[model samples]
Target: MRYLIYICFLISFTINSQESIDAALINSTDIKIDQIVALDNFETFYYLQDNILYKQNKDGTSINYSNYQLGEMSTANAFNSLKINLFYQDFNLVIILDNRLAEIFKIDFNTAQPYKNVSYVSTGFDNTLWVFNIDFQQLELYDYKTNKTRFSAIPVQSIVLSLESDYNYCWLLTENYLYQYNYFGSMISKIENTGFTQISKSNGHLILKKEDTLYFKHKKKEDILPINLPKLLINQFLLTNETLYIYDLEKLHKYQLKIN
Candidate 1:
């Protein structure tokens, strides 16, 4: 009787542990996408396909915008409803688009002297841009209208992997560390990297992907929880609030996270 009780306890513990870590696959849909830009809401998302930017609404309606001269879009940052910065690394230009998928303006980085080698760009506060100066290995807040750098951080030591920002803060992900900076270009916080390749932020929580595993943590907390994904050949994934969207080249999987 004692042995049976112990066995049952072990099995129950294992089951509970797995349940705590795993994400529940709520639904999945067929999707062909090269990259995902924004999860505007639970049902709507924006993606890139064949050099064209598309906004897929909740009701399966899609509105697309494209600029043939811009070449392929390298990255896009939808900082707010009013501003979306789309960077074309090959063309050395950044195109500003509104929420309705209308092109507002384009900034040719080639004309921005002394900071020509811009590898990445993100939307900053008050019509400014957070750009990674690849030539100088520094992060700069550039004003397109004035054609001047409003603020510049010291050269980073590691190779920058990605850049993200909102109206109040900017986050830089390097090969060695994750850095958070204020709008004034002052480093506010730094977290040591634990072999993460990609990151996404929503509602004060940070989601990181390293290898095939996903991890989640709060902005001010140190505890990291491993989020288990359903078995699939994942190309990339994104987290919006408590929902996780996994893209496997051909289909997009949606999971509802209940990590405790």
Candidate 2:
């Protein structure tokens, strides 16, 4: 009789946990996606397919931008409605595009001084770029117009895993720690790492991934919310506002998150 009671309790606990997880996921939408990006304000989304970049609006209308000379786009960062920076890592070049996907300018890092190799790049304030100079192992604020380094931080010890930034601040994620810095290249905060494969940012919230599970936390808060996903291979994912986007090889899944 005691063994029977224990089995029943285990089943009840399992069902309750599943129910709790279901309550946090409100809705899900699936669509074919190759690469996905969300804007800073969480008001727009962009996806890339077959070397074509598409800007998706709330009404489902999309605008596309393509360049044959740029080759394949490696990464894109939309700093605001006016400026979007795209990088081609293989060619060591960066292109600035307008909201309509029109090209503004292109910079070749080989010609740009003080940087022989850049492992990562992100948009920064006043039409500048936050670049990780792999040769120096330092973070630098590079101005494209003047072709100069505005500010640079001291060399870091570990290799960078990922980087995220907005107009005012930049966040660097290494294997052992996460570092936050202001526009002046001053360290603001440092958080210890615990095995995250990828990281995404929106407002003050951070979404971290490890294996198939995701964890969300506010920069000012201590509590972390764990989100378990269905058994699907995730090629990439992004979080903006309260919405989460998970991408497989051929499809993208959008989910609304209920966070307390």
Candidate 3:
């Protein structure tokens, strides 16, 4: 499929509001985590500490998986819950795990037929994955089952800070702009970046973190609203189901997102 390039200038970008939403201190769990990955459900979540992946449940039972030979576990995505994705960027490897944290499939991009230099990866629909090919500097919706690239988007011109995608859309955040694409390889929109270091997507809304501050953007609105967070050290965070989860290496904090 051919990629449609849609250029967005700074003049077209505007913030919807300067107001900040409040983030209540729902509760802070005393835990050890290097980074927060994803929420499997209300009672279960996954995290990485000391390069080992852990799935912690509210009942105190937890499961973990580790592979030290892969260098470091760059990121873990629990988007599908059952089919968890573990990306080892240094090795160009992606491992799919079962709900019980059992190894199921391994995709080594370095040795794959076409040889993809993948710098980032996230879960996608129907045995597919959102892969950022560093070789071409382009984003692709890759089908892992058939070992084929279904569609590829335009090349990103700047350094990609983060990559977030759901089933239908993918958002690529670069140094200069935040680009959004659909399932058909079409450029949906591009927003000028103020200074977001990380991003989390859920229900068509974005929870963006610039340094230690957080902001929210709606799917149908242009307003980028600031989210007022309590004074807590934030090392990594994830947003799921209108709930915000933060991990500061020592404790995990939970907050309910109240949006107007």
Candidate 1 lDDT by residue in tens digits, 171-226: 88999988888888899888888898778777667778788888887666666678
Give me the candidate number with maximum lDDT. Answer: 3
Ranking by TM-score: 3, 1, 2
Taking the tens digit of each residue's C-alpha lDDT, what string does model 2 give over 154-188?
88899799989888789899888888899988998
Q: Residue 87 CA error for candidate 3 (Å)?
A: 1.0
Each model's C-alpha lDDT?
0.81, 0.79, 0.85
lDDT for 250 in candidate 1 is 84
Indicate which candidate wins on TM-score.
3
Which residue pairs collide in model 1, if any?
none
Q: Estimate each model's TM-score.
A: 0.86, 0.83, 0.89
Report per-prediction Cα RMSD to one decimal: 5.5, 7.1, 8.6
Residue 211 C-alpha lDDT in model 2: 73
Residue 237, model 2: lDDT of 75
User: Which window of ten consecutive residues has the lowest lDDT sum in model 3?
Assistant: 1-10
Question: Model 3, 105-182: lDDT tens per residue?
Answer: 999998888999999898788888999999899999998889999998888899989998888888999999999888
